[model samples]
Target: MSTDDPWRPRLAARARLKFDPVAKQELILFPEAALALNETGAAIVRLCEGARSIDQIVDLLSKNYANADRDALMREVMDFLDTIRVRGLLQ
Candidate 1:
């Protein structure tokens, strides 16, 4: 897939999302590094399972967070996804 494609996002092969029982937090685990995710980050990552498009994720989240502005939420989601992709944690 093109790196620029935002229609569907997927966790990179080396990365996986898991809940750390000890920390009681969501984490993205890769080879030598792990990222702790906030609630919103976790929610977004969970939807990046290679099935849902960026728009779909934003739509679902907008419903779940009814107070959020759709346009702002989209920008935030895109930024988060871009950050993860740059770190080689997302595809």
Candidate 2:
């Protein structure tokens, strides 16, 4: 279990999640760059609307994906958040 305080993830002010009808996938559009997201990535980012903490997101996902390992989901959420955060896409 992680002892770190939970983080409430939110999309950066300039970032918005939208579906690209041409590409048929969700994209995180910002000022200078856009990130194409797979279904899983879309789902994860959709929850980062500042209303839930990282732990809360994991709990919800674990409930929805009963077969998924909770620990693995936690790691995945952390990694994805870190990746976006590094790129200034997440707050």
Candidate 3:
């Protein structure tokens, strides 16, 4: 899917993402593997629920970090999402 399109991103159907209470960490788990995520990555993944568009995600972050550089944040978020999308992480 095109990032420029209004497509909402979601974790792949075969993947699972959540906070692992026992591990005290966030994990992105596939059938045969799992990825540990930093807090920022975890936050981004949590918001990709196939409900909010890219713009909506940006808006949420913008409000959450009033002092952050909006343009930089946008670029970073888009780049990060694109990388994950290419890795078959996003749907």
Choose the strongest candidate by TM-score: 1
Candidate 3, residues 6-89: lDDT per residue as tens digits?
A: 889999998889688888889989888888887767878889999999888888888887898988877878888888888788
Please give the CA lDDT of all the candidate structures: 0.91, 0.89, 0.84
Cα lDDT for residue 87, candidate 2? 96
Write the residue-wise lDDT of candidate 2 on 68-87 in tens digits. 99999999888888899999
Q: Which ten residues in a row have the lowest lDDT in candidate 2?
A: 1-10
Off by over 4 Å in 3: 1-3
Query: TM-scores across all candidates?
Result: 0.91, 0.91, 0.86
List the candidates ranked by lDDT, beginning with the highest.
1, 2, 3
Off by over 4 Å in 2: 1-3
**Which candidate leads the pack in lDDT?**
1
Clashing pairs in 1: none
lDDT of 1: 0.91
Task: Evaluate model 2: give its lDDT.
Answer: 0.89
